[model samples]
Target: MADPTLKAALRGGEFIVAPGIFDMISARMADRMGFAALYATGYGTVASHLGVPDAGIATFTDMVSRMSRFAQGTRTPVIADADTGYGGLLNVRHTVQGYEAGGVTAIQIEDQEVPKKCGHTPGRRVIPAEEMALKIEVAAEARRSDDFLIIARTDARTTLGLDEAIRRGKLYARAGADIIFIESPESEEEMRRIGGEIDAPLLANNVEGGRTPILPAETLKAIGYNVAIFPAIGFLSVARALEGAYAHLRRNGDSHGLETYAFSDMNELMGFPEVWEFDAKWARPERSQAAE
Candidate 1:
């Protein structure tokens, strides 16, 4: 469906795994791996693709291009990150319209100002609650898919404190956000508090090794959060392994010294042969090469 976020919100309280992806292949891999949802991770996309932080460095066009890739690659819906909606109210409105055009089912817009830092980073600042409320209104107004969801994200708890965050969350809820994500609640008590107070459906970003508390899926379910996205969980592990392999190769003269997942298994897992076959068929390979 064009607007997947609506269906997801209507499902309301189901348990679904949202794996993050940086590009088309990774999004396809997540769908193949049995994930029902995909998270278009700005942090991961910026870092993996641009080798930098998610500090509002990426343009609206940049973010939506990746969203298009993720949406096109999977049957599952994508919940994309429209980091601070790229600018003020007008900019946010434009951002939502662009994402809808890209076929994003859902997207999260934070309250951080322009040139904002990642939610995980310190020294973050939010526009006044009233200003962000207007931005949320613009987002809702711009959404063509009624089922396409608009998630309002607040970085206030860490920046301004939990009380202010809760107040802002209510303001966003009042403004028309289908879902509210109060990023990085440090304690379960705060989590419970937000869950108890926020009237709308809730989504959580539970990145492994992040500053936020890592609650189990069941625990989050009980706490009243509807969706939990584990962004960078796989990336962190992959980075560690890749770094270890490089060090091993430099020190031991080959990567064979490190015990690792077998190459055949990894290729099978990545659908290497299938991809090669798919590539070869349409590639119009040279007759001699094909015969050989």
Candidate 2:
């Protein structure tokens, strides 16, 4: 089921800005930062977990297990990417149930066919609008609670055109999608048109260096987006920091003068203090005898 807090926030009419988090460290960090929600980015998660690209290679089990960890570990509501629902209508039903059971508040299912590519990349193809509408219907019906939102994404903007994408967005909304995502709009004008045309809650993909121009939160709200997800920012920033740290170590042959997160802080962040307290309370017989 969805987090009641997030569901309420959606109804409050404020624009939500969700940062992407791929791993526990990122999730924990974002949870502490007090965002309205966190996006479980498929590109970052697949790259971090499997060290591979976001091509349709990861299976449902692989993705859902990670989603479980992310949703369970974080306090913020999680909106996960369930790419193509991992298969047909049956798969869509299973995906919806599994994600909701795993504590995901929302699941994004795109209209891309099997072996789907990243939204900003070329050579991507979408299934027929009617077919994707059925998947949306199955997803909406499968979720146990109305709070568990179904985000319907149409990738037609990249391949077909903005017009088809808008049409499909309206169709998906009619099919019971809680949120509409028309992926990879090439220009700000196109985004404005989407916001103007689509009546339901609209999602904007703010992928840095992608086809869509990354706009500020204020501008996104003025353009009438209900939510904007920065899916690549966290992982891309981490990747750059890692590259720099590794390059410094490689050149110097020893770690010195490199700016980094404190080791002690990391220990606290990972809950080592709780483990130590548990050890003191239970693992030491002397402490128990003394208390007695």
Candidate 3:
């Protein structure tokens, strides 16, 4: 089946809510829970896979592998983070092609320098706006499908200023970016300004405990954002739940309250019935008849 087009889906007034997923399990959970889409978050990937920060350490290959897992494991549209496109314009082209082939519906690139820090974090630098714009143009052309989107992220809001971020956002949009993302908008006023100033569709990075306020999708839509991604929420929730489960086990030497749900519940959640049905449908006919 063809992948869902995130660009076309976000054209309407309602904003798309994409929960951050790092691994196939999270992706499956999001898909089963009926999220509109999935954000293959770089921060989540680095933390989950590498036990490190999103400090530009995740190479293009790492992102491609993680993105491919989500794309193949779930049917939901996935928006992946291609941090700094992993290098220059040529690198951006290569990264775009890999992500597109991996089944991602959209890729988000930022203007931060190599070894880049997360947008909400401090002590980060960006490349020249013109250079980043050129990268965006190359990424726009490299996609195999026109429906595959390029989201241009500008970290200038905290580094340069809101004005500079707006300028960079416009430059990226003119360079053919499908969506404009001004990272780390400090307040509601700045978000409103970004939404009002940028001509193209806007993306809101709604990180938990990040610089941006944790607002609902409706509020972000009213502020003019077409898409909102909660990049670390799922990972954070999973970590906390695991911490509690392990702590309870350590205290009691056995799972007590943590055993509220049976192992069968988890099996059902993971679609064990579907696997059995597939086995029954595809097993050898003679063997099936003997078993019957």
For residues 124-148, could you state the per-residue lDDT of candidate 1 as single tens digits?
8888999888888889988887887
Between candidates 1 and 3, the lDDT winner: 3
lDDT of 3 by residue, 1-292 (tens): 2265566677655578889999877888788877667999998888889899889887887778988778878888888898999999899999999988888888999999998988888998999999999999899888878878899999988879999999999999999998998999999989999888888899998888889887777888887888889999899998888898999999999986684446787787788999999999888778768899
Q: Pick the candidate with the highest lDDT.
A: 2
Question: What's the residue-level lDDT of 79 in candidate 2?
Answer: 95
lDDT of 2: 0.94
Candidate 1 ranges with C-alpha deviation above 4 Å: 1-12, 257-292
Residue-by-residue lDDT tens digits, candidate 2, 1-292 = 5787777887898788999999999999999998999999999999999999899999999999999899999999999999999999999999999999999999999999999988888999999999999999999999999889999999999889999999999999999998999999999999999999999999999998999998888998888899999999999999999999999999999889999999999999999999999988877466769799
Best by TM-score: 2
Clashing pairs in 1: 6-147
> What lDDT score belongs to each candidate, Candidate 1 first?
0.82, 0.94, 0.87
- Rank all candidate structures by their lDDT, best first, as comma-separated numbers: 2, 3, 1
As for lDDT, the candidate ahead, 1 or 2, is 2
What C-alpha lDDT does candidate 1 achieve relative to the native structure?
A: 0.82
Model 2 Cα shift for residue 67 (angstroms) = 0.4
Kindly report which residue pairs in candidate 3 clash with one another: none
